[model samples]
Target: MRVGVLTGGGDCPGLNAVIRAVTKSLIGQGQCEVMGIEDGFQGLMEASPRVRELTWDQVSGILHRGGTILGTSNSANPLRDDATKALVSRNAKALGLDVLVVIGGDGTMSLAHGLADVGLHCVGVPKTIDNDIAHCERSFGFDTAVATVTDALHRIESTANSHHRVMIVETMGRHAGWIALEAGLAGGADIIVLPEIDYDIAAIALRCRERELRQRYTIICIGEGAKESGASLTVRERVEGSPDPVRLGGVAHVLRERLQPHLKSEVRATVLGHLQRGGDPTPFDRVLATRFGHRAAQLVLAREWGRMVTLQHGEIGSVALGDVANAQRTVPLDHELITTALDIGISLGR
Candidate 1:
């Protein structure tokens, strides 16, 4: 059997690990051939698709690297245009690819599901720093991102203490607060804010004021998507024609400006933007990516087309692509972590 592999959506750590594992596992079997697809679905949309053979030698020594050896594009969606879809179909048939190991997040999976409907076999390996893919308890790249955010918070805390200031650190979480919530708890944040829960500026100001008398320093971890109660999300900008267009950002600054009037201490905001997305995969993420890759290979070998590899309740498994497509696993308001944060006296800005 011949297989194709591509990484789509935003680039993140552990992506190279997945590429290496998928290529090496299939090649080691000695019965399968693997090809690396360039620039995601955009490659296939080309009149002459960009592709190359993935020999065992090529995939070596990439496990420790960040990002994918196979290139990616977030804006390329063959499903949107019939002409592009036809071109992709023709290209796939011409290349004689039996299946594609698509590694990406929710938008990528949605594209994979649509491609499957047009007669291209696909197997998905969830990849996102947000850890918001439906049916998967955790996805690769999240651990590394969380570690980055936590480290940033640790570094920010020292300065915050020295200045006796209110430092607000913003993390990337377009729709979910997993990164902010987890990293805040790990880094001993005084207040943790999430997109899942509404936040009141007055409540946050009150908390900061209380800290001023005792702690004299306040550390807040806020998700990018977080906003004031009855307010719309803070959008950085919208990309026309992109699958996920709305870019959330600047909430930390918004929060800072709102709290500055009520708090005596100086308030500052730090946006940990793409810093969380680029880095070597953490040990946990490397292992998880390898596991997901192997599972994807198993599904492909078993002819389980249109399925996505998933990690549920500590076990690796597979779920239909349709189930994950267009769906997100947002953090629940009543989640155990939220309860833990509340019990520990961490203000959620509610």
Candidate 2:
């Protein structure tokens, strides 16, 4: 059977590894053809859709690389409506593919489900920086981002300590704070703030002062989506005809502004921005991506439709797509581990 594949939404480390694995495995069978779609659903919607042929050599030497050859766009999802769905359906048939493999986080996987509802045969592989894909212990690129953020925090630590100031470092995470939690803990951040818990800034400022009393410098790691309990800090900007509106960032600036007057202490903010996503894959991510890619190919060969490749309890496995899209996986603010951090007098900004 011939298979078609696409990587959608944000680009992550190990995407190339998955492509290489799929190509190598399919080629080994001697009876399968694997094709790639470009730029997510938008590529599939073009009038005369084009595809990249997967030859073994094309995928070689990319096992440890970051990003994908197929490219990605968070704004693209082709199965949203009749017109776009028809386009994708026509393109898939035109390419003569038997099944489709989609690698992405929630939005991309949800697009696969939508296409399936209209008679498209597909499977998914979860990919997200948030590490919030349900039933999956972890996803590819997460380790890499964690390492990146941790390193950044480490670099910022000495400066904050030397100056005896509060340093707020912002990392990526929309509705979950796994990145902030892991990186902050690893970087020895005095305070770690996440969206999972409603924040009390005044209490956090007090803790910062206490840290100052003891250590004289405070380093706080906060997720971009982190918000205080009373009001959201996002500033809505007008977009034309978007089905869902965009929620933009400013949390770091807002948090700094709020803390400045309360503490009367020197406060600074450093936004990591896209630096987290713009580097080489960490060793962990490289190995994990290779494994996920190789296993994804095996799953395709076995015809496990509607299952997403996932890492659970240190094992490579699969989970039903429905479970993946149901809701986000989040870290409990008062979890045993969280309490442990609290016991050590870490400020969670709550």
Candidate 3:
């Protein structure tokens, strides 16, 4: 069997671990030929076969590495574009792949489903910093993203306190607050903001001032899509057909400006951005990615194509690709846990 693999969407920690695990596991089966498809679906959009060889030595020393060995992309959806479809079909036939493994988030999985719908064999492994994958209990990069934010919050807290400033740390969670919520609570954020809650600039500023008066400093954790009441944070700033819609400046900047007046002194915003997705993945992510990789490969071996490896009830597992097609798992607006922010005197900007 000839297997082709690629990473898509934004880079994340544990990506290389997945690649390493998948390559090593598949290579052990002497009959299998493994190919690295560079730059997500774009690889298939480019090369005659859109695939290249993966020797054992090339996979070495990348277990603890970040990013991907085969590279990644934010473009190429055959189902969405005629050009992409032509490019992909041309490459797939030339490559002669029995199966293709796609590792990434919702957009990437959606692409995988498209290929499968077109009669291509494909398997998916969920990867998202947001941890918002539908039906999957967790995704590979979520743990690492949370830990990275927590660490940043820890460090930012001290600086904010010493300088008597309000530190607003913006994290990536386009439609969910998992990253902000978990990391905020873990790192003593006085207030945690989420896209699920409509925020009030005045309320957030007041919270910071209140914390400033009481503790001499304030730490605010805000999700990228978090908004002021009746207002949006990031607007679409890129091409419509693109999976990763370029975002305008995020809420952290606006909130930081609003918060400055309330602060007794200095105020700043730290956008975690790609830093949260880089470097050595936390142990949890490495383990999870390895588990997902192992399961994904097993699924391919079993001809369980079109099923995405999902995390269920704390276990690595699989789900039908169609189950997640066009679906988004967002933070529930009425979650009691979210309501608890009010109980603790942390405003949700309501």
Candidate 4:
């Protein structure tokens, strides 16, 4: 079989592990030819992509690496234009690829589903630090992102205590609050804010006052998408033609500004931005990515096209690509984590 693989959307820590696993697994079969597709679906639109043959030697030693060898792009969507879609089809046929493995989050998975409709054998491997992909309990990079944020919070907590200040740590979570929630819980944050729940600024201010009375510094973990009751804060205007136009940010600063007047302590906000997306994958992510990649190769070998590998209830499984296309798996309001946070008196800004 002639197999092609690509990674798309925002680069994450465990991407290289997936690429390595796919390449090594397919090559181990000895009857398959693997081609690395460059820059996501954009590579498919190229008249001649920078496709390269994959071998054991080339994929070795990449398990600990961050980012992807095949590259990625967020704005490359074949469905936006008929000509581009045709070009993708032509390129795939020209390369004689029997199967294509797409490793990405929601946007990229949606693209893979579209490609499958056009008769290209496509399989998806879920990849997201946000852990927001539908049908998957947890994405590979979520653990690493949470760990990174937790470590950052620990450092911030020390400084907050020393200066008797209110430190607001911003984490990445556009539509979901898994990162902020998990890291906040694990990092021992006094307050946790999420996009899923609108925050009561006045209530948060009151909490800070109470903490100040106890002579304890406050540490708040806020998701980038966290919002006020009826207001939204953004760091910048959305690009007109960008795929991800809702660039949520500045919520931490907004919170800091609003809460400063109500608190006696110094208030500051720190945005972790892309730091959560960088660095080496955690051990859990490495193993999960490897499992997802190996499962993808096995699916292709079995000709089970239009499926995406997922992890649920401590088991690796597969789901139809159509089931998760353009779907988001958000943190449920009744989740145990939320209950735990509330039980411990952490303000969710609700």
- Estimated TM-score per prediction? 0.98, 0.95, 0.93, 0.97
lDDT tens digits, residues 1-350, model 2? Answer: 88887888778877777778777877786457888888776678789886888778888888877788888777766755788778888888888877888888876777776777756777787777778878888888888889999999999989998998999999887777899999988888889998887789888899888877888888999988788888875543534332224655668878999898878569999988677776667777777776777777777788888778888889999887777764677887677658877888788887
* lDDT at 144, model 3: 87
Name the better of 1 and 4 by lDDT: 1
The numbered model that scores best in TM-score is 1
| Top candidate, metric lDDT | 1
Q: Which pairs clash (backbone N, Cα, C closer than 3 Å) in model 3?
A: 199-229
| Model 3 agreement with the true structure over 1-350: per-residue lDDT tens digits | 88988998888898888887788778875457889998888787764545678867788788788788777877656567776676677678777888998998988888788886556789998888888888887888888889999999999988988888888899987888888988887777888988888787778777777776688888889999887777756763676667766664367888888778765667899888888888888888999999888888888888899989998888778998888767778878777667776677666665
Query: Which of 2 and 4 is ahead in lDDT?
Result: 4
TM-score between model 3 and native: 0.93
Q: Where does candidate 2 have its weakest 10-residue lDDT segment?
A: 236-245
Alpha carbon lDDT of each predicted model:
0.93, 0.80, 0.82, 0.90
Query: How well does candidate 4 score on lDDT at residue 66?
Result: 88
- lDDT per residue for candidate 4 within 5-78, as digits (tens), equals 99988999899999999888888864688999998888887777668887888999999998887888877786
- TM-score, model 4 to reference: 0.97
